[model samples]
Target: MDNSKLPINQIIARINDAAEMAREIISEANIFEAIIEGFNEAEGTNLKLTDITNLEAAQDWIDEFLEKYSDV
Candidate 1:
């Protein structure tokens, strides 16, 4: 975690790794938001990320949504 003490190459490598991780996290978040929005549109309801209390419930909702509208 102490990138300051690392060599230049190591520091660059760590920075690159952190950037990649950030990109992945952002991508996943975007996908999750899109799925939630799609589900809300299909169901004619307005829901937000705050409405889902836990990851299991979110996954369940996504699964059900996809099962019901896989053709789209």
Candidate 2:
């Protein structure tokens, strides 16, 4: 597949366009809140993205859960 003469750049441009459209439709905070909702459901605990001090800490908190349940 890597050696194929496909228009990889064009394909990537299309993907970028879709991502840009999605960004216009939804804020990162909304995505983070959705992730927090999933985390709460999976862990059987209530959590809120707004409670996190910063994005970095929010990322770390998510990484911790992913690491703990990586096998699943």
Candidate 3:
């Protein structure tokens, strides 16, 4: 089970897959950031989007916001 013995192509592919996952995470962060910005604008509240370092925190804010603001 030694990854160092893997072929160069396999190593490159694994790196590429990791990069793709990083990109996906950034995309999700951007989407959440936009929502946070809109919420701040509409509510006049300065909820720091950048302060949220991960998706879970973003989701927590979204959940709380919905609970407090959603009528449906």
Candidate 4:
């Protein structure tokens, strides 16, 4: 799939789907922490999961992260 060509909502949905899969295989907390780490690395900002208040905030982070790291 050419994810970079997808719309923002589709990218977010794919991220959510991957997170869900990770949750089923691992712990949700672990997956969330990993997400936070990826976000921090990709965005060059330190952000813990607790710093995100809602889905919108998380999506914003995901959007920026994808802008930089989608090819990964």
Candidate 5:
């Protein structure tokens, strides 16, 4: 089947739509990273928040938790 049978304007519209969707997905990923980073930085500074019984494992735990919860 030849796509040329369709109007050029319609093909352009579909391409533009896909591009817009990609941009939106990228934007959402950025926002999610910002949220996770903000939480990590804020918690890192607070002695009480950062002070876990297992201090050696706390940072890893926090990072893993944030990464898990930060979803699209």
Candidate 6:
């Protein structure tokens, strides 16, 4: 698809939409991890976590989760 034909406002709007989607995905991943940890704790079992691609990816998720609560 040739996006150059679109207006500048349309391009900016698309960028914003993509960013919002990325933020939501990061937030959801963080929430999922928390829920899994809580369930494991409640069951009195060891919770093993797999490594992400790198530290940056992990930090992104943590940041988004913290932003949701305004506390980190």
What TM-score, over all chains together, does every model reach? 0.84, 0.49, 0.70, 0.45, 0.52, 0.57
- Return the clash pairs for model 3, or none: none
lDDT of 6 by residue, 5-47 (tens): 9999999999999999999989987876785475456557654
> Which has the greatest TM-score?
1
lDDT (10s digit) by residue, model 1, range 6-69: 8999888888999999999999888988988988888898998778889898888889888889
What TM-score does model 5 achieve against the real structure?
0.52
For each candidate in the order shown, give its overall lDDT on alpha carbons.
0.88, 0.78, 0.82, 0.81, 0.67, 0.70
Highest lDDT: give the candidate number. Answer: 1
- RMSD values for the candidates in order, in angstroms, are 1.5, 9.3, 3.2, 14.4, 10.6, 10.5
Worst 10 residues of 2 by lDDT: 1-10
Question: How do the residues 1-72 of candidate 2 rate in per-residue lDDT, one tens digit apiece?
Answer: 552565988778778999998987678778777778878888898887658988688788878877876677
C-alpha root-mean-square deviation, candidate 4: 14.4
Candidate 3, residue 62: lDDT: 92
Give the local distance difference test score of model 5: 0.67
- Model 6: lDDT of residue 7: 95
Tens digits of per-residue lDDT for model 4 on 1-72?
A: 899899999999999999999878668667777878987786689888778789787778678766777788
Kindly report which residue stretches of model 3 are placed more than 4 angstroms away from their true locations once superposed.
53-60, 63-72
Pairs with steric clashes in candidate 6: none
Q: Give every collision pair in model 1.
A: none
